[model samples]
Target: MFSRLFDALQGGSGVGAAVRRRQVDAEVPNFAEADDVRAAFFSSALQHAKSSYDAERDGYVWGRTLRPSYALQLHPLNTVQTYTQKKEFVWVGLTAGPWFVGVVVLQFNYFAAFSVSLYNVESEESWRATSRVPLPGPWLGGQWVPNEKGEFGPTSAGHRVEFSAPLSTHRARLCFAGRSVQVDATGVVAQQLPNGKSAGAQRYEVHAVATLPEEFLGVVFPLGPRRAALVSKVAAAPLQSPLKLRLGGTEWSGDGYLSMDYTRGLLRRETRWHWASATAPAGYGFHLSEGAYDVDNKSVENTFYAGGRAVLLETRVEFHKVTAAAKVWTLTGDGIQLRFRHADAHDAALHVGVVKTDLYHAWGTFDGSIRVEGAMYKFDRVAGVLEDHYALW
Candidate 1:
């Protein structure tokens, strides 16, 4: 039954063939709008109608097909118009000097939410602000805009994002303003996957750097899926960016790591997961994730990127909490083992009648080893994040 469902979700045809056929003489869209550029960059002809887990391969075969486009055109499997129950989001984070800044834009059926956070590595200080607004209809409408770049988020909502291109090297801008906090920043993709096509089981990813010129309070903050019931799609990229920031009228600059995350999908009533990633010296980066959405650990999102290539790992990862406060945790897998001690943390709880969410994100260091493709890489102290999230809707 699952195989049949997976086949159906892949359009019941050779996905590569179908995708190739659709690409014949297809010219990339020419648009001036940033949103339109993103839409074209992510757009795909495949429809994700169901979720499938491949036990033999220990991977989750995405129901959505990947093609050469600027935007993703994702459709829900069911006809129900419960927009609020559906979720889509784009999150970006960057580290500058002794500070880390993050931006998130989330859209549901009836409303949109935005968040901006800043963390100080030396003082272990963290601050976050969030807001939400009502959305009357589907966020982008359900149609593709030809020769134009679609827009994401409204200025009135206190957050907005724009992209320069869909594939290869690109640039993006994130702007936010609310109360005493205001930020405007730009991210330039220095390197990315050769093209916008999937390589075997790996998703598209990029490396970027962001810049912010102004200061907010004591910090110059610049930063930055599909599914059925519980369907999810995620793209993870490691970034090497240098940034200049101002805090309390003081200027600072340093090299830092950055990451971009985009997700869209229908969700189950309950969900939980453990996810972690980090960038190290010598162009080495790693990503690890495990949980309910991982489909029995078969669809592991674990990979190591080195020397401009990515190596996907087949392993089991476990997360052990050393304390209830979650200030310390242990992560172990077939070829990886690491310990994390939280340096800074953020927690949020939201309840809107039938829907509820709890999130904990910790920034810290990992001390251990990661074996990629039989080569063991060691880390004495590598800065990164550990996140635990749960939702009930």
Candidate 2:
């Protein structure tokens, strides 16, 4: 199989060659206290005051409570104890009303990618499709395991995608050929904080969410040393309910909101990133990402969702373009400021030799505003999506 995947990539030992291997003096782990990792998922109880993966009492926990098992032996690639790379992916975005949808499913065990997109805010028109397969293909199945219980379904090209949550009824489906999208939500519950105060379910206290739990930015750091660990979970919410879209063939259903991205460790072998997702319908929204699994800024997956409550932006959101044919892009930090006017885009690329991508999916309109805490949220033009990625996995 491609010479044992190029002898596990020129024999440097997995996790993308341990991200340029060079650190091993031990002593790492002890940086999770930014208010207990932002109240560690503010509690409804998926429980994790420490449950697994501990280089020593865990490193990050904004909540999903660790508990992922990795075992790839053959130590000494410079010790992180045989750090194997296990990355999983799930990205979903929908803004129902006038229609805006996106779905992504990726599994890099050998190769996998699927994408479906549509946008139409009173007739601006857009449709996109993508599919790449090559890893014991069955579409995709299992292993984002934290609190457990998840499902994925896929057969082959003429695509159909499915995601199930099993407990609080989180379902998603996207069909091909004729185009389709259906989403049913009821996952996070417990809300009431426009100062009316109700948000209770134990711990971390109030900042509500009614149709969902919109606040999941789980973290676990260390990429060049300290056991090389890296875990992630990102969420953007407003899938408040009622969303059904079928373009060109006309179907359209109401309401919108959903943005999810999840991850698993040992990455960085030429990974680039700049992501943005917007949501609205009174529940406001934002989810901005910064390059390759945190470069030095420790923890930052930048989030700010209100009305559905989930605010954590310790500053660090910057993506400007003076080149790459700038179509007008600027994302600032610290109390935030935004401006993205690209209007229609969905380009995907794959070089296939060692796996390469040029992924771009710009679909714009986000006029600016975000101040959290001191309260000041706004985004005049709204309607979002901006992902400019480059990967060599």
Candidate 3:
């Protein structure tokens, strides 16, 4: 199937074929005049066409397609420094009925990592495994944006971890300490039409393809004059196919939400951030963060997904300090207030020569509400995860 898609992208004249497009001029739009949060945020004149990659301007886009309309090439502003600072990763987090599942494949120019974690919500039984191996060369790891059909992984040989994200399905397999974890998640695409034409083509033609699952956030922020990073996030609806999570010889399955993180490009040497993701049944979810990417008039990533549609929450978030004895952490911002109760955590501290990392992925329940456009959406004790991350590479 992928072979045919690749062949079509290579020469086919269909919608899958890559088209040559120009970048949008970097002009800030009047977000105040926009109708909805999604429209206001996406109204930024700094947009990127599906087939465009601009080193001078940063932008974001989202689509209902399982993969991107065009393959993202490795284009570095500081070409000579690409080998040292470039990074790529594909992370998927799911909330099955009584389980929390995660699969991540990450590759820095220096090393690559594959991690799989599973938590039984009711039993409080948790297991996680992380494998980090030094990269022999810059091009040694797997590709995040391989072809038109799209595939991402840190498929370093002998790692015992495998993951694939294609147009139709997402599957992952991991083995550690003689125990194993597997995930199979699938979702139905919301077919959209504009003027009786395929939304993909129409969006490509107008450079408006960066829209959503109905909601998404993508941005390219400058790390330095010569360095920048592209971070795209999506908090999507529950999958059509029941989420299947297998761990310790038992299988757990149910409808759940999915959130993805796709980050690439040169980033800061030292970075820290407080991130949170939570989802309620019936397609209510949000992705919020407070560091790494600056929140200003033109750049922000905080978003709410209501009814499978993305709405912008362009306010700075404050993450309260988390201590060993901390049970509930408060997160607040304009029109947003939530509490995250700690359940269990996967913590790790890695100090390899000059590279250092202190990471914590905590899973629990989120109880609170957020006000959007004068309407309050509230949830109680919905499954969620909070992350405290500091890295130097």
Best candidate, TM-score-wise?
3
> Which parts of model 3 have CA positions greater than 4 angstroms off?
1-48, 55-72, 76-80, 136-145, 148-212, 297-299, 322-327
* Candidate maximizing lDDT: 3
TM per candidate comes to 0.59, 0.29, 0.68
Which 10 consecutive residues of model 3 have the lowest summed lDDT? 201-210
The RMSD (Cα, Å) of candidate 1 is: 16.5
Alpha carbon lDDT of each predicted model: 0.45, 0.49, 0.53
RMSD of every candidate to native, in Å, equals 16.5, 19.4, 13.9
In the range 1-393, model 3's lDDT, one tens digit per residue, is 475334222222112322333321222233222344244234433343342233234323321222222323323223224345566666667765776666677766466665655555677555554555564333333233342323222111112233333232333343211111223422221112223222221000000011135445655454433244556666654564567544333455677666666676556778888888876765677888887665353226688877656777878888895456666789999988899887666677889888898988787788889998798988677777888899987
**254 Cα displacement, candidate 3 (Å):** 1.8
Q: Give the TM-score of candidate 1.
A: 0.59
What stretches of model 1 exceed 4 Å from their correct place? 1-70, 76-82, 134-241
In terms of lDDT, which candidate is stronger, 2 or 3? 3
Q: Any runs in candidate 2 off by more than 4 Å, and if so which?
A: 1-4, 7-85, 96-104, 108-220, 223-264, 267-278, 281-284, 287-302, 305-373, 376-393
TM-score computed on alpha carbons, candidate 2: 0.29
User: Candidates sorted by lDDT, descending order?
Assistant: 3, 2, 1
Output the TM-score of candidate 3: 0.68
**lDDT minimum window of 10 residues, candidate 2:** 147-156
Q: Over the stretch 29-63, how does candidate 1's per-residue lDDT look in tens digits?
A: 12212353334222331133122322233222332
Q: Write the per-residue lDDT of candidate 2 for residues 57-111, one digit (tens) a residue.
A: 3232333322222221112233232222444566666665666665665545565
